[model samples]
Target: MLLENMKMAFHAIRVNKMRSFLTMLGIIIGIGSVISIVSIGDTMRSLFSSLYKDVGLSQAYISIGYWIEDVRDSDYFTMDELDRLKEIFGDRIAYIDSAPSISGEVKAGGNKLKFNLSGVDYNYQNVQPVNMIYGRYLTEEDVKARKQVAVMEAGAAKKIYGTEQAVGRTFRTEVYGSMTEFTVVGVYKKEVNAFQKLLMGSSDDTGAAFVPWTLLTWPNDLIYSCRLFADPGMSREDMNQLFQEIMFYIAKSKGRNSQDFRLTTAMDEMVQVDSVMGGLSAAVGGIAAISLLVGGIGIMNIMLVSVTERTREIGIRKALGATTRDVLIQFLTESAILSACGGTIGIILGIGVVFVGGNALGLQVVVKPAVVLLAVTFSAMVGIFFGIYPASKAAKADPIEALRYE
Candidate 1:
């Protein structure tokens, strides 16, 4: 019976193909926009989530005196104070590391490469671990001895040595206009992800090099930012309180206000991501839904017009033993098929857009089964809701009056 009704619906649509296509346009655009946004957003979220998982989420980033000018050397966390923090927190604190960001050009052989530089302490690797393809990471002895050793990312290593395994090679860079030589002790596989690309602010060609944070002789230049990762067993509340206390201690030690510093944790990032995605989905989805509503209204108007045009046919069918329920179901079926077809096309367009957009934005693309199902179901519901009144009007037509008209 459903198949028979769908055949009649197809016949009706075929009779006015252009009108039907025009009517479906709204549904297509509405569903397409929403699905594309959702797919792309989900892909981006998944990518970042993976990155944070690999980097671990038990970490906190502390930035001190960022906007404060004339900040004294006492305002920064000294090596002694860092040691005191470890002693105070004991095993509860997994690692604390400081990194100062800078940029310099390094020369190897005849090749010179300009790269982003991170002056990191030995413990920095504990929080931001990378896959080392060659040699080894910096050691406590290296930092304590103020060794002029550096680790190069694969891209940088390739640029300098034409290979990723360039251990025991020396690179030269000038610090404060004074030439300093660094022996490359390690080469690491570069992170080739959207997050890393964005963080580096360069294409795949650019590379990052890490040297001992102690290379920066001035205390004021050493601890611009620090990362502290707590033990996994620590609760969120405890970690927050502990970090607050540490910041307070820094403030007290420097004779500055505690508010001058800021600490950002993984939990904070998680909440912010959720809030932003939620709000974005709501805003974009809400606007797209207006198109669906307009489409539904157009369907209702067209269905009513169809009822008027086929009034005589409806009456003849009623007189020939067709029930009102039969007439209603046929009309409802037509509306549903029309909407379902639009939704199917919209899904295809949306997925295609996601693929293209993902490639352009350098993010992965994904099509969620649940979201696709929801879109189809929602389209059918829209049809049914709008088709009800017109179908009812058709079913209640008087056989005598409808037959007498024209």
Candidate 2:
């Protein structure tokens, strides 16, 4: 019986092929819009979540004496405060790394490469650590002796040596004052940075070059930024309170009661990413939904016209043995098939757009399974909803009057 109704519906659609195609347009567009937006968002979210893991666990490196105009700006721990903090917290305090960021060009193997420079102490590795692929990381001896040593990141190493071994090789770094020479004490494999390509538009040069603080320029400017991982079973709340107190101490020293610095943890980032992306994601989804609504309305308009054109046929069927239910079901089936076909095609087109946008242009397209299922379901709902009133109106027509109509 279902097959028979669908067969009749198909015949009707084929007879009015152009109208059927036009009716399908709304469902097609609605599905396509949703798929495209969702796919991009999903891709970006996955990419960034991976990046966040590599960004080090939540604890911020507190700095000092910058362009802080307000008292609120000075609300963080400083270099001097970290020493006292260690005394108060002891083994629970994790690692402390104090460094200032700078850019430098180093000449190695007669090749010059620009690199991010960090003048690190012994505890630097424990805090802002990287995987060492060649040689060894900077040692306590290196820091104690104030050795003029430098370590290259993967991209810089490749540029300097062209796949040759960088360990023990001498490199020249032109500091502000004079040219300094250092032996390559270590080489490291770069971290997997998802954002590197997305932000830089290139996969090369993500590794940072490391140097002993005594050997690098800008010595006095080295403030403090510490990384404190929780102990095996310590509560995050306790860690936060401890860090807060440490910041307060620093704030007091600077003559400010409140520490004016940002304190971000993994929990904080988790909340932040959700809050920011949630709103943006919702806005995108909301905008796409409007298209679906418009499409549904278009279907209703087209279905109404279909009712008027088929009045004579409806009358003839009623006058013969066809019940109102059968007529209504037949019309509903036609709308359903029409919209469903359009939705299927739209899904394919939308996915194609997602692929082109993501791979060709490197834009983020993240499609949720739920979104696809919802799009399909919404399309069906639109079809039935819009088709219903028209089908019912046709079923209610008086046979004598409908047959007499032009």
Tens-place lDDT per residue, model 1, 118-214, is 7777877766788899999998888888799998898788878898888999888887667889898998885577655685477555568888877
Cα lDDT listed for each candidate: 0.80, 0.72
User: Where does candidate 2 stray beyond 4 Å?
Assistant: 1-4, 14-18, 63-80, 90-92, 121-129, 176-178, 191-195, 200-207, 213-218, 221-242, 252-255, 265-270, 359-365
**Candidate 2 lDDT over residue span 1-406, tens digit each:** 8999999989988998998888788778888988887777666666666566555544554544355565342344345555677777787666555544566777776677766677777776665578788888888899768787777776667777876358888877677568878888788876444455665555464335788765652445344445454342446577677667766666667676444544456545755786676677668977987887788788788878988988998889988978989889988998888888888888888888888877775545576778788888888888898889988988888889888878
- Runs in model 1 deviating more than 4 A are 1-22, 54-56, 63-73, 194-199, 203-205, 217-222, 232-235, 252-257, 356-362
TM-score of each: 0.87, 0.83
lDDT of 2 at 156: 67
- Give candidate 2's whole-model lDDT: 0.72
Lowest-scoring 10 consecutive residues by lDDT in candidate 1? 216-225
